[model samples]
Target: MSTPDIVLTRIDNRLVHGQVGVVWTSAIGANLLLVANDAAAKDELQQELMTATAETAGVGIRFWTLDKTISTIHKASARQHIFLVVKTPADVLTLVKGGVPITEVNVGNMHYSDGKEQISKKVYMDQADKDAINGLIDAGVKVYIKDVPEDKEQVLQKF
Candidate 1:
């Protein structure tokens, strides 16, 4: 198989914010931001907001559900540079289960919610989140927690 064009896979709840829209996009030189999120794919307002943010960074973006994302993996891989973003570890698990070749995943932000443990400044994990991360690691996908390109990477282990 040929090498996939997707250069980065990130699990960021704030899918296309200032950090991802500008810093990460420019840092990785990724021309495309493929947001694999079911909710975002159906929400017009959220889609518009993300698109506007991506435009500010001069990066193209497309939103798709887990199934659609898997189906279009071939075409997305043909693009020059793709920065894949998903909302949760569960989403990443879905993609991996669907045969997406994600060698690594960066956990940007999970947010501090009720019944969740603080894993990092920008990442919080509930039992389900922890389970999903473990599943990905077992699948041989390296997962790390980092807010930005400048932040030190924390390996997403059992926690």
Candidate 2:
């Protein structure tokens, strides 16, 4: 099975916003935006909104559950350059554990919430998030914190 080119795997709490739909999509040259989140896969309204955003950006979009993303991501044609976005590090871990070939992850916006520690300007993490990120690092994935394409990449380590 041949997998699509995963141009960027990003974790952003606000899934498909202006930065993602416009900036990241154009910057990465991704033909498809693959959203791997359980909540998003089942939410019709969210799907519609994100789909419209992708279309406006001149890209195709797919909302798939983590399991679906794992099983069928390889089915995409080689010409499909995919930008995979999820809400959390845990979801990225799930995709990695499920055998999706993710070697690098861009930490975008992990919102500040109760019980979460600020890791970067736009990123926060609790114990679970830390653990998931550590697991990814242990698995040989290069995890970095960067909100936008133009920003300098901060390698996340020992946080």
Candidate 3:
């Protein structure tokens, strides 16, 4: 198996949306959109939702669990262009540790959750989230906080 070039890896709470499915996908020119989330992988409804959204964007999508993602990393990397979407920073850390070779990550929209503090207009992070993101940074992954493809990339420094 060949290692696929993961062109872009984005952390968006809403994995597939107009901003991501259309804007980011088009900007990155990705042929494949992989949604690596444990919950979405096991839930048929979530898979269907992502599939439908990706279909609208005219891109291929696959919802895979962490383990599944690791196992299939080589195959995914073999592709020409791949845009990976995960729900959290923790997921990104896992992918990197699993030998995905993610050097940078776009922190899109984490949304306003219960304990998450608003770091930017479209981003929110709790302690654990912050730690995970920091971990990626410490591991040499350049983390950029940007909502859309047109926005300026901001480095997350709230940790």
Against the true structure, what is each candidate's TM-score? 0.95, 0.98, 0.94
lDDT of each: 0.90, 0.94, 0.87
Q: What is the Cα-based TM-score of model 3?
A: 0.94
Top lDDT model: 2
Model 1 lDDT tens row, 9-68: 999988889899899999999999999999999999999999998999998999999999
Give lDDT tens digits, candidate 2, residues 5-117.
99999999999988999899999999999999999999999999998899989999999999999999989898899999999999999999999999999999999999999
Flag regions of model 3 displaced more than 4 Å: none
Candidate 3, residue 112: Cα displacement in angstroms equals 1.3
Report the number of clashing residue pairs per model: 0, 0, 3
Query: How accurate locally is residue 143 in candidate 2, as Cα lDDT from 0 to 100?
Result: 98
Off by over 4 Å in 2: none
The residue pairs found clashing in candidate 3 are 3-77, 4-77, 4-78
At residue 117, what lDDT does model 1 achieve?
91
By lDDT, the candidates rank as 2, 1, 3
lDDT of 2 at 151: 99
